[model samples]
Target: MKRVLVGIKRVVDYNVRVRVKPDGSGIALDGVKMSINPFDEIALEEALRIKERGAADEVVVASVGNADCQQQLRTALAMGADRALLVDTASAGGAPGGDLGLEPLTLARVLLALVQREQPFMVILGKQAIDDDNSQTGPMLAALWDRPQATFASKIELAGEKAIVTREVDQGLETLEVGLPAVFTTDLRLNEPRYVKLPDIMKAKRKPLDTLSLSSLGVSSRARVKAVRFEPPPQRQKGIRVKDAAELAAALKQKGLV
Candidate 1:
């Protein structure tokens, strides 16, 4: 169907001030506001645009998490994804002892399974998730699928079976052309996601949202990395006021900075 598979990740809303749990187990997500990862939203926006331009036939959004993740998936559908898929990890034993958090490698494996099943021409994902900020999934998926990948793509254009991607780099923007059946990770410069209108939200409810289990995908949810603990950044030291540059220089000298 010349489909474009887009990955969505559920993360604490960027607006929320995250708190470390009392026990340092993890960030307190119990009552935190959750939403689709902003980068992933950008990725979906690009995919939707591609479809709107008639370059792709279908846009399927997918996510890996508990049932709560469906909320974000439905939100993607509302954002214009034609269909949504949720890899339900709630029932499939997660981590070493059932921790719901999945590592980047595990996520790559899950996506690879989906890639094999769907055989989509292209896969799109956020360059990184806000919560973890480990920008590893896209590359890992490409390696596992043995497909070309263009990461941190600020712009993309399709021509027949090839894609020209403009990547954001420290050295400046770099461009590359890759054939179809590749992977792309979106950067912030990508198009902003469209707002989900009320009518679309209602229509999304009726869109196909299929649920799959880890077993069905032949991918294990067990995490490869164990999170020892979460620790908050140390509080910044109080700033001292100096009356003059000389005083500031003195202070700097006292601190061995000069």
Candidate 2:
């Protein structure tokens, strides 16, 4: 394979507590924590491993977010992406996100144009983001591109312009034969990702990263779902205390016909 595209994201750090407002419009994150999305990291790791295995020529990591995403994008570079793309969308005046976060479909639109232009041999995505838990973008992009896709992939093989993917299914394991120019969403079991060495980290600073805008790709940033209000949830009621196992059984019996 010649070129591989890896979709990266920036999200709240994994340690932060996330709560949604009553209106379902926004999250109550304090902005005190942030990091690269985990799924994307798995994708990057698989792509780099493919390169290490002499399967692919280059790996590129891309992210759609505001200015702060650059630092996170650089992490992918440090992890071994040959280049990067940072997409900006807030300028179009659309509400960037609510409690649910940015729409994955919109980001897919931007990548559609990119795929057409780059014509990469394959595209890789994380199965889901930790916060939103919406695993739609990868499959959505595959559908948009009309290419076969494999998810939860633990092993991948590229040979003679065809990709043989091994993924985990409910029963044992399932394998698929897909041509080049396919999409893959990776799980944690794919492989262990490597940390960047000092030399590669320094070289990453010189790597080229081009900025792309929604307008340039002829895609709009408007979100279909509107979030109008936000509020906190009612405090959960405490559980009642029972004296012992016999008392708990007695309470249950008293509350019911038993």
**CA error at residue 178 for candidate 2, angstroms:** 1.3
Q: What lDDT tens digits, residue by residue, belong to model 1 across residues 1-258?
A: 889999999999999988888898877788788999999999999999999999889999999988999999999999999999999987865434322378888899999999988989999999999988889999999999999999999999998889999999999999999998999999999787899999999999999999999889998666557778788999999998999999999999999997
Candidate 2: list runs displaced more than 4 Å: 20-25, 97-101, 228-258
Candidate 2 accuracy as lDDT: 0.82
Residue 8 in candidate 2, Cα distance off native in Å: 0.3
lDDT of 2 at 105: 88
Model 1, runs deviating above 4 Å: 94-100, 242-258
Instruction: Please give, for residues 98-167, the per-residue lDDT of candidate 2 as tens digits.
Output: 5454688887888888898778888999888987788888899999899989988888888777888888
Q: Which 10 consecutive positions of candidate 1 have the poorest summed lDDT? A: 92-101
Error of 2 at 164 (Å): 2.0
Alpha carbon deviation, residue 51, candidate 1 (Å): 0.5
